[model samples]
Structure formats: C-alpha cells, structure tokens
Target chain A: MAASASASAARPLAGDSLTIHVSSRPQLAMVSALPRSSPPTWRLGLGRPARLSTRSPHARSVRCLAAGGGLAPEMRATLDKVVASHKVVLFMKGTKDFPQCGFSHTVVQILRSLDVPFETLDVLANEALRQGLKDYSSWPTFPQLYIDGEFFGGCDITVEAYKSGELQETLEKAMCS
Target chain B: MGVTKEDVETAITSSLSPSHLVVTDTSGGCGASYEIEVVSEKFEGKRLLERHRMVNTALAPHMAEIHAVSIKKVLTPAQAQPQPEPAADKAQA
Candidate 1:
C-alpha cells in the first residue's frame, strides 16, 4: 500500500488533471466504477437487474425520488454498496458509543448484547442521507438496522426480535452465509 | 399546531379498525411523539414490519407534524388474546 501510494505521488503532472476531473465528477466516477467493483453483491441482495444499460434514465429517476424525499441515484447506489459490504449496518441518529436518541441507544445496546460486529452511520450528521433513508427503507423512523444487506427494521422491531431470540438466530444465519 | 393523540387514534381506528388500541402522547402536549399499541385483523397475515407499516400509512398525513412515533405493539386479535399485560413496558425496560 505504501509503495503504491508513493508510486502514484511520483507520477508526472498529467495525472493531476485526471485527479481533478474525478473529484469534480464524483457521481459519474462512482456510477462508472460501480459495475466493476460490486455488481454481484448488489444483484444478490436486491434481485434487481444491474443498472448497466439504462444509466441516464435510471439516474434521472433517482433525482426525482430525491426530490420526493427519496435517494438520489448516486446516494442510492452508494447505500447499495454500503449495506452489501457489511454483515450488519445501522443508520442511526448518532454513533454507537454516543447515540443521540433514546430509540437509537436501545438498538445499539441490543446489538452489543448480541455481540456481533456491526457498522453504524450517523444520520444526524447528514441531512440528505437522513431524509433519503426514510424513503429508501419505507420506514419513517431512525435506528434502521440492516442484516445481510436486507432491512430488518427499526428499534421496536429489533427489540421485539431480540426478545424472541429471532435476532440471534438471524444473525447466526447471516454470519454463516 | 402539531398532531394530536386523538388525531392519531382516529386515523388508526378508521383505517385498521383495531380491536385494542392505545395511543400515549409521549411528547407531553406537543403531539410530536407517541407510543402506540394496536391489535387488528388487518395484521393477521402480516409480519411485524408490515404491521408497523399499516399504522404508519394510516398516520401518514400527520407524520409531517409528528416528530417521533414509537409503535410499541402490533398484534392481530388472536395473538393479543393470550397476553393481558402491556408487553411494551417490559420490553422498554
């Protein structure tokens, strides 16, 4: 990693222009790079056809969704990658250690009690993501939990599932899969 | 003006026709927060998530004014018959 970093740094001024372009057109770069990096995971979880052919129309629709409190395509695609990349992911009001909401804190405790590795994204820090997530999950509440790239539910559901041992069973299944 | 406990009750009652319903205005008087327990036939074949969705859809119009809605219990009438206690209180603790 160090050698690669140094090698990139040593490249001539021609590489600088490419870097600038990638930074300016981040959404385009992400859309183009997505197919190569993480298509299979996205396909397996959602079962939707990959957005390979209808990129422009798909992107336009995503923007429309964003306007309606849904996710922008780039944000949607990024979330697709995020959820798929982890065994568990939580989008909550605050970090795991310092939850901002009582409901968010409860979910964090339950996950900790289960003793499984999980990733959390603080929605309070990002306004766009906070709103977009409600539309994405079709659930209006926060502390949204995802297991195996599928939305499990929010705090109440998680607590109920935990009480019944269903959460443990599902986590075990996800762990193995 | 924000949403009211009565408004929430009326919405869920009209929509779900729940046999047992409790709407606690946890937001004091502001009506921004609530905890609900509902039992209805509509939830008979649904999962917990779907049951919550039904309640949410019923309250969709008022959702803009309400800041928090904690759906404490979602049950079908048959499932609710066996337990007389408020399971939500125990779960929260």
Candidate 2:
C-alpha cells in the first residue's frame, strides 16, 4: 500500500515535468528562429494542410514557424478554420472554466450568463497561436469573441453589447442561421 | 517602464481627432493598463469593432508596453449626444 501511494505521487510529478518539457520545446524553437533575417517564405503553400485535421502535434511547430516569419499565409488559413469552426468562438487567454486574465474571465462570465454554448481556445498554451491571432483579428487584446464567423469584439464590447441587448439579438440571429 | 495616460491621449487625438476623449490609467501607476472613452467624427458610420480597431491602431506603437486596454466607449459626436427622454412625457400623460 505504501509503495503504491509513493508510485502514484511520482507518476504525477513525472507527467508534470514531461508537459513542461514539451511546451518549452516550441518556445526554444521560436526564440532560435526569431533572429533569422530572411524569413522562410518559400515554405509557404507546401505540406501545410489547409485545415488542421485534429489538433495534430505538427500544429505547434507549424505555428512556431509561422510566428517566426511574421503572419504567414498558412497561419491565416489555420485561424480561419478555427474561427469558423463554431457559431460562437472565443479566443481567450485561458479555457472557459479557467480564465487566466481578468478581461478573459469577465468575457467568460458574460457568455455564461447569456447561456450561450461557445468554444474557447486558450492562447496561453500556444505562443504562436497567440501571436498569430493578434495579427489575424488585428485586435490587440484577448477574449476576442466571434459570432457566426465574424470578429465580434473584445471583452468591453461584449459587455456593452450584453448590456444594450444587441448581443442577444445578434446571437439569436446567429442561432437561427 | 510603460506608456502614460497622456501618451495614449496624444496618440488617439492625433490619429482620430476625437471631439471628446478620456484616458484613465488603471494600472496603478505602472501605466500598463488604461480605460479609454473616445467620441470622434471618425467613428461615424463605423461598427463598434472598427471603432475599437481605430483606437488599437492609434495605440499600436505603445501597445507592446501596455498590458490591458479597456475601450469603454467609442462613439461618433452625433451618437454621443444625449437623447430626449420620451419616457418622462409618457409618465406625465
């Protein structure tokens, strides 16, 4: 019994370190690739699936490559697919249940209060996606809400829209569509 | 070091030429956060997202240092005008 408990505790610790190692690998690649003066633009239009099939391991590396060379067209394609994946999508700092930032949390709460089913992408997990999204939306902040494949706005706009009843109206329309 | 409230105001003023503007430093002297309310003719006919984009673009230079920007309000001069309250008249009736 004692040995089993010790092993179980060690298992979680090993898993935690493994996760940290995997996540840090991409950051190291990003830092190294940043100083390369000439962007590998030639890598464009090659080997990248127009849409990521199932959040493959290659996704992070692809995003890292894209981030290194500014907003690559491939990155734009991926973002396009992501935004259009659902009727309501929120590219936020953290997941819906676990928002890392205050603004992100506020928006999550508003959406929850509205009782609308939405999808959230955690930008904190993926640095490349975070940078890519900033360029993709051209909006400087997180908690970017998208309704019906449109860039709705950030937290403040969502709150204002919620207050003014416009968000519900728009959501109704989107749901109907 | 981060951007000042005055710096944000100047950037918005020069870019959008707002008739009314308020920039509040919400970062407790760190200057990394702000709450802005801008009323400009440039916002006329633009959607809320576009208006916010205008503000973001205006502050693009300083956005790196600034952590949070809550654009509380973005309105055209016309939209900013107080509307006549018809509810008062109805109540009197």
Candidate 3:
C-alpha cells in the first residue's frame, strides 16, 4: 500500500482514475482488464492501451493534441481532426524553440517546465491560420492553449492555472490518456 | 481612402453595443496601427478571444487600411474596470 501511495505522489495526476491499475508480474489480469472499446491494440503510441495505467511514459506522449482554431465548417472539422492527431497542441506565436512574442514564450516555458510532450503550430508563419484562429477561439490573441481538443484559455489563463496547479492536473490527465 | 479609429469604434459600438469603448491610433501619423478596448453585454459568456474576433470581423472590410490592430482589453461590463494600465495607454507590445 505504501509503495502504491509513493507512486501516486510521484505521478499525482496521470493514469489515476482514468486507467485501471495492474501490476507487471500479473500479466494475465492486465490483459483481461483492458476495455472492450479499446482498439485491437498495438504497442505503438502508448504500448498497448491495456498497460496504460501502469506505465507513465506512454501516457505522456498520447496526450498531446491539436488546438482547433479554424472557424469555418470545413476548416473547423479539419482542425478537430488535428486536435486528436496529437495529445497536446498549442497554437502559439512562434515555434516551440523560438517564440516570437513574450506571451507565446511564457506558454512554451510552462509546457517545457512540465516536461510533457507537446506539439506547436506557428501562427506567425501563416496569416490565414492566425486570422482564422482569432475567429475560432474568439479571443483576440496569440498563444492559445487547447487540451483534449477543447479551448482551455490563453496566456494569462494558462499562467493563472499554472499558479494554482490546475494546469499540472490537466496536463497529467492529458499525459495519462 | 483611409479608416479612422472613430469609424472602427462606431461600427463596433453599433454591432456589440459595448458598455465602454476606446480606440487609439497607433500608427503615429498614418492610420495604420490601432488599439481598442471594449466592454459590452455581448461579451458575456464569451472568452477574450471571441470578443476580439467580433471586433476583427466588424473591421474586416478595412483590413486594407488598418495594418496593426491590438485588442488590449475585451471584457463584459462586469469584468471591465479601471486596471492600473488602461488600454488607451498600452504600448504596441
């Protein structure tokens, strides 16, 4: 019980309630506990969705997703597909390594510090994406965040969430699934 | 030939009926850059991004004349207030 508790604290967010836990040695039980809805299953992104609960690394990569920032019907649908493409996605001012704006840089730092895998779209490179994103989120700013294919908020909101530890929890959940 | 800040503000006011409105010419002498802060009932339930879109959509026709537009503050009447830095005084950054 103490070992489980320590593991929980170390992770604290990912793969908790969302996944059914099983020990490595008990291979048969882990295989049986796998959800019926889960795909036929390969060990690709998260190493067999069945073992997601026990492993932390797989959960982290699977959570990166796209931020749906396209407002038109066709573009909106495409963006929806993109959000599901990765586990975490950020529509930012610059690329992950070189942020063009201060606000975009702040978000990049937050994601980096968390050490979670994330994908970024550089709005600065494309005028249509930039303008369309403004319409899509209806927030007149760059550096927007999307979790689980939903708009979480922008730089200020991300900062506030980070301060209150909510961002960590959200990211943990994202990483878990 | 050129668009004025008042033109932009008036269009937004008519469309969104904001509680407060401020428009500034950021282009020095030319009507290129503009900054705006709008507080409106329509902004309720909408995020800052959405509010800015409404402004952007309303001004889409003048995109040719307007170059840099910074939406400094977008809030409903309840959320809008006298912050330490008002949108009127914010720098381009």
Candidate 4:
C-alpha cells in the first residue's frame, strides 16, 4: 500500500479518450423490472455461472441505469479500460499511504495483509472521478474494489470476503490470469 | 445537523422489516456512527455481503451525515433462534 506511484492516468475530464470500448465484462445495469418488494437477488454472488451473459435483454437501452452521478460516457469508458488493465483496482477516498477515510484505510490494510500487488485511485484527489465512480459502480460510497475487471464490493464486503478467505482466492485467480 | 440513531433504525426497519433489531450509537456522543444488528426473514437466502448491501442501501439517504456504520450482524430468524448468546455482541473482533 505504498500509493504505488500514480498508476492511474492524469487525464482530466476535459479530454475524453476517443477509445470505443467493446466491454468484455458485464457492465452495471438497473434491474428495473424486478419487483421493489424484494431485494434484487439476481445481483448477488460474484462470477456465478449466470454472470456470463454478454447481453441480457433487460439491458436494452444505454440509459437503463439510474441517474449517473454525472459520469460521462467517455469517462466511464476510460474507467472500464482502467479496470481491465489491472487485475485489482481500488477507487478510494485517498492514497494507500495516507488513506483519508477509515473505510478506505480498512480496505487498504486488508489488501496489504493479503500481500497482493494492487493499484489505488485516490477519489479525493479528483472530484469528477470521485463522483463519476459512484455512478460507474452503482455503489454510493468509497473504497470500491474491483478484482479482475469486476466490481467486488465496498468496505464491508471486502472485510467479509477477507475473513471468509474469498478475497484471497479471487485475488490469486486474478494474479494468475 | 447530524442524524440520530433512531433515524437510522427507522430507515432500516422500514426497508428490511427485521424480526430483531438493535441500533447502538457507537459515536459515544455524536450521531455520526452506529453498530447495528438486524435479524429478518428477508435475509433468509441472501449471502452476508448482500445482506450488508441491503442495509447500506436502506441507509443511503442518511449516509451523508453519518460518518460510519458497522453492520455487525445480519441473520434470518432461524439463525437467530438457535443462538444462546447475542450473536452480534460476540461476533465482533
């Protein structure tokens, strides 16, 4: 957790990279058709057999997701590429060396304890990126973890995963890949 | 102004409709942090991570003011029944 020498590119939101991403991984989409009476059970479990769908009919429109925290399409594309480039990515409130938030620090400490080589993107340093990520991940908070181009979960999930030895297993697979 | 612990409890109870609930103000004096235990049938088939996510989502509106929230326990009524001791209290490290 040495902050890892700025692995993230310094591209501001001004210059949208002209990269058209054919997303190989499943992107976040709202399951609006599901009844609100129950918690969305379909979104549970990581890398389940059902997650292999490259295209689901429910994901017809680009705007199927709710109000993005104003994260632009191009910015999301850059993030998608970022998640793909690294086996592990942590978008947190601060750098790993000096994590500004408790939750971010906890997740950083967990990753460090596991001794897996991971990159950190300090959301606090970039406002647009910070807000953009909340929308990009469809998760409202910081310390969002991505293992092998997948949104693993937040601080609590990371802690639970660490305790159950799931995080290690996932990271090991990602590292080998 | 910060949110009270009851506000957090209200949000969670209304959403999860837990059979058992305990909301502790872990912030000492302030209303910024809480330690919660919720046992509900809604969590019957859900994984621990998803259970926590449900709690987090329910409290999303109040999250701006609250500094931290530790969801200590989320279990179904069946899981809660067999336990002799308070699961949430003993489970924390």
Model 3 scores a C-alpha lDDT of 0.59
- Rank order by DockQ, top first? 2, 1, 4, 3
Model 3 DockQ (Cα-based): 0.18
Query: Please, what's the RMSD in Å of model 1?
Result: 10.9
Question: Residue A32 CA error for candidate 4 (Å)?
Answer: 32
- lDDT by residue (tens digit), candidate 4, A4-121: 1121322334223322221233223422222233322333122112222233232212221353434443345456555654667788877888899999999999999999878888
Residue B16's C-alpha lDDT in candidate 2?
Answer: 98
TM, every model: 0.75, 0.71, 0.52, 0.71
Score chain B of candidate 3 by TM-score: 0.83
Task: Give the per-residue lDDT digits (tens) of candidate 3, residues B1-93.
Answer: 578878888788888888778888877857877877777898889755466567776776776577667666678877755565454465434
Q: Score the docking of each candidate (DockQ).
A: 0.63, 0.75, 0.18, 0.26
lDDT by residue for model 4 (B1-91), tens: 8889889989999999998898888898699888889999999898776787788889989987888888777889998889875566564
Ranking by TM-score: 1, 2, 4, 3
- lDDT of the structure predicted as candidate 4: 0.67
**Leading candidate by lDDT:** 1
Q: Rate the local accuracy (lDDT) of all candidates.
A: 0.69, 0.68, 0.59, 0.67
Total residue pair clashes for candidate 1? 0
User: Candidate 1 residues A1-177, lDDT tens each?
Assistant: 111112223122111122211101223333355433222332112323234423323121111122123233334455555555567888898788889999999999999988998888888876656765676666777989988767788898999999999999989998987
When summed lDDT is taken over every stretch of 10 residues in candidate 2 chain A, the lowest stretch is A15-24
lDDT of 4 at A54: 36
DockQ, Cα level, model 4: 0.26
Model 1, stretches more than 4 Å misplaced? A1-70, B86-93
